[model samples]
Target: MKNRTKELLREGKRVLGTWGMLGDPTTIELAGIAGLDFVLVDMEHTARDLPTIEHMARAADVVGLTLMVRVPDNDPKTILRVLETGVQGIVVPQLETGEDAARAVAAMRYPLNGDRGVCSITRASRYGALRPKFAEYVESADRELLLVGLIETAAGVENIDDILAAGVEVAFIGRRDLSGSLGVHGAAEHPMVLEAQERVLKAVAAHGRAWAGLVPYRKPGEEEWITHDVPFAVYRNDISLLLEAYQNGVRMLGRESASAHGQGGQR
Candidate 1:
């Protein structure tokens, strides 16, 4: 499997993606159809289990979408389970130290780059069909996996340099959680939160690493982040978009119907 997302990043292109937090393969497929470069299947904030994640990964593969997963934690089993499903990479949450980052990366790769368990029977290996070329596959996968480290906690930000050195390809600022860490719950736009985010961005840039985050769709400040050197951005989550679209559609149709009825009464 090829990691198109990593290829885009290597080309110095901004890769746009969306969140597949609804635990539905359909949403992941839709992101692919919409021409998104990737979709992050979230296991951190959702109830999605291994089977559901595997299904989403397969759907993404079928639709030619680059699939990455946000694992719930740095547990070796959790990371292995997600990667074995054939996703292109993983976003490890709440990573606070260099050791944490290193462990996460190790769990993503085989013994060549790291100590990830070897199993050629996985979908990642084309279900053992690629066993003949197993060595080559391991090396390619180790190089191509887009391991992203999330800097959402105070400790993570403080140890940002160490985390960067631990071989993560991207440093994603989780502003919502960072806000909580900064003592302001859910205040992602608060000054402290923005300042903390800037700190993380500066650290990433100084380390010569790429950065990513979720952008507010209707907000006017997206240009600021782009200018600030955030090359990867997730537009929104499937659940949030679905909710907004459904609510807006209902409201608009209701208004139009009411206006039409009033005009008919005038007749």
Candidate 2:
């Protein structure tokens, strides 16, 4: 299957995707069927383990959905292990400086370049089916794999320029965490958040790299002026989207029932 995320990135078009915190293979499959270009298996806030993540990655691959795993920490072990699961990319969070971003890239590479240990029989190498040409696969993995650095904190924003120069293919703006660090938790539309986001975009653009982010909109009317030059966009998470729809449906039904009862009493 073609790497849709890479294709979109190369084409300079915005690739839309969302977070998959559910950690269920079925949920990941459904998300893939929904036509998202990619789905991030969130290990930071989710209870997903290595086995579960591997299952999710397979489901995504079956449906041609690019799987990107957000490792729990910036640790090298976590990064390399997750990559071995055949995920197309890695999203390293809480990146505070250029060195942090560089370390992530190094962890995802092999020796003589980085420290990713050799694994000729893992799922990433087609479980030894492609082992004969392991070197070829390794080279391709280096070119195809995406390294995303998530800039969320005030310090990260301050060091944005350096982070972009660290050879990160994409820099994601973690809006919620960024807002919290700026003392405007959940206020993604605040002037402070807007300014920080603009700074990140400018820095990323200057470095000729792509930027990805999520826009939190509670209602239809809230979708205004969010169009930036972001080449990747994650609209919402699965749980939040499900909860919002359920709430709206329940409220609408309740209101309809109340209106019917009132009409009958009047008659």
What TM-score, computed on C-alpha atoms, does each candidate reach?
A: 0.89, 0.89
- What are the clashing pairs of model 2? none
TM-score of 1: 0.89
Q: Please provide, for model 1 over 124-228, each residue's C-alpha lDDT reduced to its tens digit, 9 standing for 90 to 100.
A: 888999999999999889988899888888898899889989887898888888889989998877899788777877887788765555454333545433325
Best by lDDT: 1
Clashes of each: 0, 0
- Cα displacement (angstroms), candidate 1, residue 12, comes to 0.4
Span of 10 residues, lowest total lDDT, candidate 1: 258-267
lDDT of 1: 0.83
* All-Cα superposition RMSD per candidate: 5.9, 5.8
- Native-to-model Cα distance after best TM-score fit, residue 59 in candidate 2, in Å: 0.6
